[model samples]
Structure formats: structure tokens, C-alpha cells
Target: DQQVKQNSPSLSVQEGRISILNCDYTNSMFDYFLWYKKYPAEGPTFLISISSIKDKNEDGRFTVFLNKSAKHLSLHIVPSQPGDSAVYFCAASDWGYQKVTFGTGTKLQVIP
Candidate 1:
């Protein structure tokens, strides 16, 4: 089965602090990973991605780490701001497969 799990449905953090979201997958054939950030009433937007060949990828305030051996991944946001509150989704896909399996989602609440 292709099941990507985001165990925590919600998380809260104060402004200017770090926020972390976790995800786990059961499928071992997945070769590429991606993270998306979605705001209310809008489609998910690509944030960062990592290849199965790489362990970590970072973009400015956001960082994603993939552990292929453990079949786990995490997204880290440094000094999260109030504007950063939104739902985050972890997605995975096999090489050459356009279809991506997404985690349920994790809502991040940033306190002002």
C-alpha cells in the first residue's frame, strides 16, 4: 500500500521559533520526496524537495531531511513567523511516476 503518514494533525509554536513536522512512509520504492505548503482556500505550493540519492535539502528558512534507510523524513522551519502558519504536506513518488502520494497534512499554528 502507498501510505504516507503525518501522525500529528496539528502543531503550535510561538513566533520566531523553530517548527518541525514529521512524516513516515511504508513504500520502499519511492525515489523522490517533496514538501508542500498550503494556505487556507489555496492549492498546495511546492516548498522543497530531495532526491532518494540525497539526504538533505534546504532553502532559506526551510529545510528537509530524508532518511532513506528509515523511510522517514522531516521538515524544519527556522524562526517561524506568524505568517508561516499553514498546512504542510509531505509527498513521495517513484522515479518517472507523475502521481504523488501526499500525507494527510500538518497544520502549523504560529502564535504572534
Candidate 2:
């Protein structure tokens, strides 16, 4: 069983458009949710994060929203740029647990 899931395998968006990526999780014990972006041959880089106490977090062009009751979250990029294209992963962890689970990544292509 998947503790974290990203239903969409890929997404394409035009430059300057909005891109939305979805994620769902089965574990309610998860207290911290994070998003990471990875490029080929490179390690994943942390993008944004939200603690269970918050519903939303935003930084510049990236925004992450969490709906705890539904065990769902989404990452949104406004005016996406070509350089923003990457594989995005959703991760979750419980503060008391040693394991951090990651969802299957969603490949994003921002067409210029």
C-alpha cells in the first residue's frame, strides 16, 4: 500500500501559465508535508513545506496547500518558467516516526 501517491505521472504547461500538481496520502499520522523538485542527475531539492498546523504555505512562485481531513495536498506554480520544469515529489513524515515517505514523482514540462 502506498503511503503517499501522486495520481498524475506527467504534466505540461505553457510558460507564464499556472501549473498544478496533486498528491494524496493514506496515513493520517503524517505531521509534516514537503515538496521537492529534482532534475536529471541531481538530488532532489526541497521546494516548500507545511506543518500539520498550517493549511497553506507560499514562497515566491510556488505555493503548497494541504487539506488534512482529505489527506490531500497540491503544489501550484504561477507563471511557470521553462527552468521550473522538473520532477516533483511529495513527502510526508510523522514527527515521532523515523520514516519519511515519498510519493511517486510527477514530471512537469514548462513549454516556452
Q: Per-residue lDDT of 1-112 in model 2, one digit per residue for the tens?
A: 9999999999999999999999999998999999999999999999999999999999999999999999999999998999999999999999778578999999999999
Give the best candidate by lDDT. 2
Encode model 1's per-residue lDDT on 1-112: one tens digit a residue: 5489999999999999999999999998889999999999999999999999999999999999999889999999998999989999999998787679999999999999
In terms of lDDT, the poorest run of 10 residues in model 1 is 92-101
CA shift at 34, candidate 2, in angstroms?
0.4
TM-score of 2: 0.97
| TM-score to true structure, per model | 0.96, 0.97
Model 1 residue 13 CA deviation (Å) reads: 0.7
On a 0 to 1 TM-score scale, where does candidate 1 land against the true structure?
Answer: 0.96
Candidate 2 stretches with Cα past 4 Å from truth are none
